[model samples]
Target: MGQLDGLKTVVTGAGGGIGAAIAVAYAEAGAAVTVVDINGAAAEAVAETCRGHGAAADAIQADCGDLAAIDAMLEQAASAMGGIDVIVNNAGVTRHAFILDLTEADWDRMFRVNAKGVFFCMQGAAKRMKAQGSGRIINIASVAGRGYQSSSNAAYAGTKGAVLAMTYLAAHQLGRFNINVNAICPGVTYTEIVSNLLRDRAAERGVTIEQMKQEAEKSIPIRRGNDPEDVAAMAVFLASPGARNITGQGFNVDGGLINS
Candidate 1:
């Protein structure tokens, strides 16, 4: 049997990038997955892929930044999947602006989806998990959260730091309920977010996007940026029985980019 046989998982932002990879990976492990994204079409596409892999999958479109939407999403997802055994709070956004250039709106938008969204999603999932007596929560944070030198802006970093901090607090409070909460700090992954950031940076430096990517690889000790699959693998492990004792921690999937 697969490691996640009979598991029910809900992954926000699963329409693409690392979130999509995680949802597919969970389905491949024999779990039913509810793919949540702001884009209905994208979510449906990912759900189809999961179903193609012979797993039960459903698509739901909801803005994680909206508490009401989050509440509805959880209710629908739980009903669709029977119950939630795992929740991956992978929905996040970043606006590239230095502190000096950053506007209040940018900061607010970043926190709305990145920080506050994570908090509400965790709360909704924890309620169900607590009653079930077991669950896994994986928040997608970034290496920027640790205050490392990154291409992202200060606001982005701040939001991630909040996510990591929330993960720790949630884990501490939920461990007694057999809930495992952890954060994944990915570094320069090849997602659309990074792609856009690289394009902008490349233009600023008068370099090709490919050249910019190569330069980024030099900073990572592994000499390579991460792939979505890299983060997904860790998420799968955290949802498995192997991670029963692991909680209240943040795992870096950054190929040693952030040494600390």
Candidate 2:
């Protein structure tokens, strides 16, 4: 049997990028999955991909940053999948601006979606998991959380730092219930988000996107950018029974970008 056989999982931001990859990976590992996204079409698309992989899958569209909406989404997801064994809090947003140029609205928006959204989603999922007496929560954080990066905005880093903090707090609070809480700090993964950043940077540098990407890859010790699937593999491992003894830890999958 597959490692995740008989498991039920919910992945937020499942429409694209790392979230989509995680959802697909979980399904491939023999888990029923719920693909949640703010975009209905995107959620459905990912759900279809999961189903195509022979895993039971459903889609739910909701604003993850809103507590009530997240509750509703989880309810719908759990109902569709029968129950939830794992939750991947992978939804996040970034407002790229220098500290001097950043506004209150920018900071607030980043926290709302990146930090607050993850908190409420984890709370709602933990409630269900607590009742069931077992579950796993894997949050997607970033290397920016660990230190300053010239390319990333300060607000984004701050929000990811909050995610790491939440992971630790949640692990402590939920360990009694057999719930595992962990965070993955990914480096420059080759997702649409990074693609867009590369495109913009290329424009700024008067170079092709490919050239910009190559230049960026040099900074990573791995000598190449990460694929979304690399991080997805970590998420799947963390969600499996093998990782039950591990909790409250932030694993960095950033191609050795931050060696701490």
Candidate 3:
């Protein structure tokens, strides 16, 4: 039997990137999945992929940054899937910018979707799982939160750091209810977000995108950037029975970049 057999999972920001990978991974592991994204068509496409993988899947388009939308998204998912067994909070955004380049608007946007959205989603899912007596919550953070030197921007890092802090607190508070809360810190994953950042950075430095990518990979001790599946694998594991005793921690999926 699959590790997550018969489980019902919801993946936010699942239209693409690390979120899409985690959603597909959960589906492959025999879980019913709800794909949540701000983009309706993109959500449907990923949900279709999950269904093609032989799992029951649905799509919901809702802005994670909106409180009402967050509540409604969870309601719709629970209504359709019967219950939520696990939730992967991956709704995040960032851009390529230095510290001085960051503005109030940047902090507001990142915090809304990355920090606030994650916290409320965790709270909403925990309330449901508390009654059900068991659930897993995985927050997608970034190595930037751990003080990665090459972070795209300070505001983005702040948001992720807030997620990690919440993850720790949620785990302790929800443990009695049999709910697990943890965070995944990804580094240089080969996703569209990183691609766009790289493209822009390359232009700024007058380097080819490939050259920029190579330089990034070289900085990692493992000498390669991560695939979205790398993060997905950790999400699946965290939700599996093997992680029943684990909670209140941040797992770094970076390539030996942040060895703490």
Predicted candidate 1: what Cα RMSD to the true structure?
A: 0.8
* Deviation in Å, model 3, residue 138 alpha carbon: 0.3
Q: After superposing candidate 3 on the true structure, give the runs of residues whose Cα lies further than 4 Å from its correct spot.
A: none
Q: Against the true structure, what is each candidate's TM-score?
A: 0.98, 0.97, 0.99
lDDT of 3 by residue, 22-126 (tens): 999999999999999999999999999999999999999999999999999999999999999999999999998989888899889999999999999999999
- Sorted by TM-score (best first), the order is 3, 1, 2
Model 3 residue 3 CA deviation in Å: 1.2
Q: lDDT tens string, model 2, 179-198?
A: 99999999998888787778
Name the lDDT of candidate 3: 0.95
Candidate 2 TM-score to native: 0.97
Ten-residue stretch with the least lDDT total in model 2: 147-156
* Arranged by lDDT, best first: 3, 1, 2
| Model 1 ranges off by over 4 Å | none
Q: 66-126, model 1: which lDDT tens digit per residue?
A: 9999999999999988889999999999855567998988988999999999999999999
With a 3 Å backbone cut-off (N, CA, C), the pairs that clash in candidate 2 are 187-254
Candidate number of the best lDDT: 3
True lDDT of residue 186, candidate 3: 97
Q: Score residue 59 of candidate 3 by CA lDDT.
A: 97
